[model samples]
Target: MSVLRIDTSIQGPRSASSALADVAEAEWSAVRPTTTFVRRHLGAEPLPADAWAAAITGGPLPEEQRTPAQRDAIALARTLADEMRHADAAILALPLYNWGVSQHAKTWIDLTIAGAEKGERLLEGKPAIVLTTRGGGYGPGTPREGWDHNTAFLRRIVADVWGAELTLIERELTLARVNPAMEALLETAELMRKAAHEAASHAGRAAASSAR
Candidate 1:
């Protein structure tokens, strides 16, 4: 089996979202020992911010008439889209950044959409686990209850647009341990972390079973 794993964490080893993804991948690997993973690190290697626009503009032009940038952008978009289209399962680590989706993840998502056929569900009927972490709590009754603008957008794309059987693992207050101001919330943060990891593990095993 082939699984597409996309990590968009600039924090490297310290990333909470990536840590959850590792848990999921480990569980999946345990179940499917011979599975192959196609990896993409958008945070480590960001797509060109202008690539999506170039690809969009180049779509109607003949190959010979396209500029070098446009040609490259189109090719890159196709590669990203193909990765999702062909994956048997997927794991995505896309943390919330500045109250919204990070530019790195957004660019990757846009390019993938640009490359696919219009309205085509690239991951149709496939299992996809999305691990998203937040530095602050935004749940009901919290001061920032309505401030989160990341998770819902992801749900729309992964489940509604791509048509994946989505399993979302979310952890909030990720900065509690590091931010002195959030000391009182440390316990809550730890609990959230554990829950997210547990969810990821369960999702991974489920994904493996479903794929099989």
Candidate 2:
């Protein structure tokens, strides 16, 4: 079985979202020892910022008439879309940045859409595990209630657009231990962390079974 894993965390080794993905991938590999993993680390090797626009504008033009940049963008976009289309399962670690999707993740999403056939479900019938982390709490009654703009969009794209069987794992207050202002919430953050990890394990095993 093939699994596609995309990690979009600039925090590297300290990334909370990637940590969750590690748990999920571990469980998946444990269950499916022969699973092939395709990895894309957007933080380390980001897609070209202008690729999406280039692809969209160049798509209608004849190949011979397209500029080099446009051709390359179109090719890269198709590759991104192909990864999802070919994968049996996917694990996406996309953390909240500035209360919304990070630029890297958005670029990837746009390029994939630009490359796909109109209305194509790239991950149709596949199992997708989305691991997202937030530095602050945005739950009900919290100071930043309703401030989360990331999770909903992820759901729409992964589940609705891609037509995947989605499993979402989220961790909030990830910065409680690092941010002095959030010190009091450290206990709650730990609890959320533990829960998210447990959820990741469950999602991973479930995905492995579904893929098989």
TM-score of 1: 0.99
Model 2 residue pairs with clashes: none
Candidate 2: segments with Cα more than 4 A from true spot: none
RMSD of 1: 0.7
Clashing pairs in 1: none
TM-score of each: 0.99, 0.99
**Worst lDDT 10-window in candidate 1:** 203-212
The Cα error of candidate 1 at residue 44, in Å, is 0.9
Indicate the residue-level lDDT of 159 in model 2. 97
Q: Write model 2 residue lDDT over 1-212, tens digit each, in one string.
A: 89999999999999999999999999999999999999999988999999999999999999999999999999999999999899999999999999999999999999999889999999999999999999998999988999899999999999999999999999999999989999899999999999999999999998998884
For each candidate, the alpha-carbon lDDT, in order, equals 0.95, 0.95
lDDT comparing candidate 2 with the true structure: 0.95
